[model samples]
Target: MQYDSISHFLRTGQEHLAKGPVALIFAEDDVEINTTLRHHLDLGFSKVVLFSPAAFNIAPELAEKCPRVTLESPRGEPMFDAVNAINDAAIGVWLYYCFNSEYLLYPFCESRTVGEMLTFHTEERRDAMLTYVIDLYATDLETNPNAVSLDSALMDRTGYYALARNDPDNHNHPKERQLNFYGGLRWRFEEHIPADKRKIDRISIFRAKEGLKLRPDFTFSDEEYNTYASPWHNNLTAAVCSFRTAKALKFNPGSTFQIQQFKWHNSVGFDWHSRQLLDLGLMEPGQWF
Candidate 1:
């Protein structure tokens, strides 16, 4: 169902989510997922699922270190089907799903607990999008002062926009907020693209309770257009999508679509979807938590 405002969306039986559980799903390659799981478990996440490509390089023993981690091997099944299994079995559950490379930035641990984080207003829940700040220097955890800068050039080249930190926010919370930094520069992307388009690279967190359906024909490509498909996104950008909305897209993981289009900002589908959500009045500013 479509919503005109956060309040309207909240009033649509979405209020039931306030008491649900929250889960996080990460891919096997994501080393940061280990850290994120530790943080979440400390905050009280009861169920966390890890989906790994059968050939993932990370050692299973490493993932086993986290008590809350539950690994799922997506070897032969389609991606959506795997996600659906989690959603169906875990309905009434809130999800903060993301790649191993992404980290939670706001409502930090010292400032709030996992229980407190899940207590979002219906409007906030419906319009809320999870955003990641790239810590190019990996200083978010070490220094009290954190820096954040928006790199438009990188956005231009990689089709993804990133924020870097030169200074720090001395807000004084519990632990220094963690940053995902396995690659040369430690950073994360928030992938929130439209449902109709192809390819997405940004990390995302979703709420399973919303019941959004995903389109089975979902596919991605590097070229602008394919013989049987449309260009995913001409701009190549990504953002976090609502769990309900993401489910509605029904993306097929096993399709022959090229993974090259999956990089940040190379797929236009997410950019258009972001615009559509804003234009439809379905999204609200300051809603990202």
Candidate 2:
């Protein structure tokens, strides 16, 4: 099933949006789109809404399960606008959003479902979960020219670091429990990434509320929702292993020639396991044990 516009879909796509933990996928490219869709479906996303200009040709198998909304020049609106459009229905519901080439990873994600993770997170009295956007790319541009490979994806194991987050309210005092995270592809290829885009931390998982809005910088309008945890203590965190940046770098006509090779000394074959992300401190395991 498909809709010509977001408004129509929001009005009639009740089957998909009726439940919670909706996965909003903005399909910019068809690379592994079927697999990405199937991944979220497998993880228990009650609704999977895909917004794309061109139809993902490989998604016929799951077409009935997911609805593809035709977006004219989808890039015109920031992703948050789409989320906010359905903000009314999303209130008090678990919401997760990401692009085509990114995958959500939680502690012990391989063995658990996203619904389970959210259930546990909600039990701990948390409204949002901070996730590190760990960059993923193909080691061999020859074997994987697109810089994306579901089977043999490679990621940096030891380049992550964080500095005190400068608070907009008060520069003298940094935001409590938050940091300006850095490293991975953005750190190595700083020339391509912008200063405002360098931070890899995102609160991708959150419980939506009335008037809630996701800012362009990956934070939320509600200040507490943007915090790393509750005012008193730390909460569990997750990871988003993304190939979005890598795929963009390799596909962009300008960057393609400049980055003929992506492999360097720090490059290592990603184990494709959650343990690697946890071991590197990219994700926190607070109260998950």
Candidate 3:
């Protein structure tokens, strides 16, 4: 089914919304939009909802597989408003949100489905999952000028760090168990990126509930919702190997010329295996063996 507006979809697509573990792909300008959709579908999402303009011209075969909705692309605060709108209507469903060219990878995703991970997460009494945006770029920028190549994807195997997340409302006392992660492209291209946008942590996967709110910083309204790990143990953490930042660096007219190349000696080929992220401590596997 198709809708001209998000409101229309919310009002009419109740059956699709009822399904759990729904993946929302808000395609901004990703050249790898199809791959993004395919990744989510392959991960066994109960339903995949796409919010993009008709100009994206989603392939016929892919469009036929999921409900497509027409939405004017958002600017300024990214997709905060659009994602929140969907979250408001997605109560009781485990929702995952990301832009095009961003892939959702959880611990041990190679042999397991996202559903299985969420099931174990739910069993641990967790309603939200923490995910870090690990920037990925093509090693050969000229060959893949768009900065996205599933075949030649590369990521920094090191350089990730975390700083205490300070709460202004609480007189600057640091939030418990929450840290603003930084590294990847956001680190290398700091001059072009905003301070708030530099944080790499995101609460992208969560079980939506009444009054649940996603802030501009990729955190939720509930304090605990912003945590990166379960209170009792070191629960699993996920990462999104995103080309969004690399795309911006290469495409943004102001910064494009400044960034001559994205590759460096530290870059390593992404083996497309969870083990690489696990070995680097980028994502935790929790109790799963």
Candidate 4:
């Protein structure tokens, strides 16, 4: 159920690598580890691989179902490297990666499983799926100092936008069908977040292949995997409802005292449904009617 290290898992945990649609959850802290694990498990993933530190407390039942890899420090480059390593090992498998406290939301997810969605996506010839990381936070930071409360979660309904993704190698021409999406907590708190980390667009659901590398910027070595859709029409896009930003701002000494609250006039309670996200234009179902 657990491995001593990433290498140890790769060497002996080949059974887990045999399947498709595995979720790789990297826990930076102990926050919401059980719920996050349970969420993906409920999504019908073939395997849920958790990379967490030894000190983090995990629910006994969840610990039995999910494979936990002992990762003392899961952040920055190391996290990306681990993803790349696993990706290389599980060639052709559909892989989804996210941090703890993040939940994946696809259209009609209440009834349809993630595997079903991927099946439809694959039929359309898409090797990857674009997802927006919608920032979620507790409305009252005074009571929830960490700015994370699932019950009190709020998200900006009107802050999302996207710009052309320019290709430097192609003389700065915009990449076809690719856009650098922005907004959520990153856009609102730009001072605290680095410019490079401000984009919300991520190819979160992708098929792993030989030599596939997940970059530190949350992209892949294969440029096509970074596209938002196929050249002809719009494709399905998912949303990752996350409290990672809110938690980070409160955790960091620099921004902790500055942000007393995360709510505004435009802030609305997250309904935790794909319909609400679709109505807000956060994600699209495309041709998946």
lDDT at 201 for candidate 2?
Answer: 90
Number of the predicted model whose lDDT against the real structure is largest: 4
Who is ahead in TM-score, 1 or 4?
A: 4
Query: Which pairs of residues collide in model 2?
Result: none
Per-residue accuracy of model 2 over 125-179 as CA lDDT, tens digit each: 8889899998889878988999998777888877778898777679668877677
Pairs of residues clashing in candidate 3: none
TM-score, cand. 1 vs. native: 0.39
Q: Model 3, 1-289: lDDT tens per residue? A: 7878788888898788787899988888748888899898998899988888877877788888889888777433546776777788878789999888999988778789898999998898889989999999998888988888889999998888999989899999998889999999899889999888999999989998888888877899998888877778888799988999999999899899898788888899998888899899999988866
RMSD of 2: 1.7
Candidate 3 runs further than 4 Å off: 74-78
How many clashing residue pairs are found in candidate 4?
0
Stronger candidate by lDDT (1 vs 2): 2
lDDT of 1 by residue, 1-289 (tens): 2223223324562432344445444553433445545544555554444455434444465355332223444322344554544454445555555545443433333455544555552333231233422222111212211111112111211223212212234443322222111211111222233322222322233445335532243211111111111123111112333221111212324321322221243312222223443442222334334
User: How many steric overlaps are in each model, in order?
Assistant: 37, 0, 0, 0
Q: For every candidate structure, what is the RMSD over all alpha carbons to the true structure, in angstroms?
A: 17.6, 1.7, 1.3, 0.8
Error of 4 at 162 (Å): 0.9
lDDT of each: 0.34, 0.80, 0.87, 0.92
Please report the TM-score between candidate 2 and the true structure. 0.94
Estimate TM-scores for all models. 0.39, 0.94, 0.97, 0.98
Query: Which window of 10 residues has the lowest lDDT sum in candidate 3?
Result: 74-83
